[model samples]
Target: MRLFLKFIVVGFLNTVISYILFIAFLSILNYQASYTLSYCLSIGISYLLNTKIVFNVNRSIKSFLRFPLVYLVQYIFGFIILYLLNQYTKIENHIGILIVIFLSIPLTFILSRVVLLKKIQ
Candidate 1:
């Protein structure tokens, strides 16, 4: 319960950071490129928060290296959902983005918590 709450908090913060950066970059770059940049930037913040706050683990190079995979999976999965929603429901792009992010939070939190907290050995 506590972990999920923490995850939601961090995820909301990350989503704000991501959307701001995405819009900023979107003006100068293509949609996919802007989204990629924002997503990557959010991963850094997410990693720090998840390690120290949610998981109560010290930062590790091993965990950091693996961390992007979580976002990568989330990104791809989210994009698919966004695309489907857009196709079927004519949802606005930003709204689709929000829905996608909300849907992805659980899987992203689970993968990071389980894999990032374990010992390498």
Candidate 2:
């Protein structure tokens, strides 16, 4: 429960920061470009918070690389589910995206825990 709470806190912060960056980048660039840039920026923030606060792990090169891989999984998972949701239903794109983001949380938490905490002392 405590670790979950930490995850939520860090996750919420990451989401808000990333959203701001996304909107800012969107105003100056195309959607794909904006998202890619913001996603890359947010990866650093998320990895630091998850390591130092959420999972209490030391910063490591291996963990740093693994962190983005976890998000890549989340991104792919979100993309597939969002695509299916949009195809089979009348859900709007923004709504579908939000749903996909929420749906990806548990998986994100599990995978991140595995990546960050599984080898701890």
Candidate 3:
């Protein structure tokens, strides 16, 4: 329970930072790079925070390599879901994104715990 709460807090901070960066880029540059750049940057930060602070994961080279792989999978999954929601639904983009983000939390927790933070067998 406590760990889950920590995950929410850390994830919220990380998401806010990345979302701000995404908006800034969109507002200033008006480029078609909002989804990719923001997702990557946020996920990277999230992975680091999750492992080191949220989970107190034991650091290792293998863990470092695998963590990014897990994130890449999650990133791709998140992007596809968000894009589809934005295109197919009447909901606002941010709201749709939030829906998708919230839905993925359980899946992400499973992946992070089983893959990144799991004690090596």
lDDT of each: 0.83, 0.81, 0.73
RMSD of 2: 2.7
Off by over 4 Å in 2: 81-96, 119-121
Could you give candidate 1's per-residue lDDT for residues 10-113 as a string of tens digits? 78887899999988997899666777788889999999888888788878888899888888888899778977986899787667778888788878878787
* TM-score for predicted model 2 compared with the true structure: 0.80
User: How many Å off is the CA of 24 in candidate 2?
Assistant: 1.9
RMSD of each: 2.7, 2.7, 2.7
Q: Higher-TM-score candidate among 1 and 2?
A: 1
Better of 1 and 3 by TM-score: 1
Q: Give lDDT for model 2.
A: 0.81
Model 1, position 2, has a per-residue lDDT of 82
Q: After superposition, how far is residue 24 of candidate 1 from its true place, in Å?
A: 1.8
Off by over 4 Å in 1: 119-121
Q: Cα miss at 78, model 3 (Å)? A: 1.7
Per-residue C-alpha lDDT of model 2 across residues 61-110, encoded as one tens digit per residue: 88898789888988778767867887899996546656766887899898
Candidate 3 lDDT: 0.73
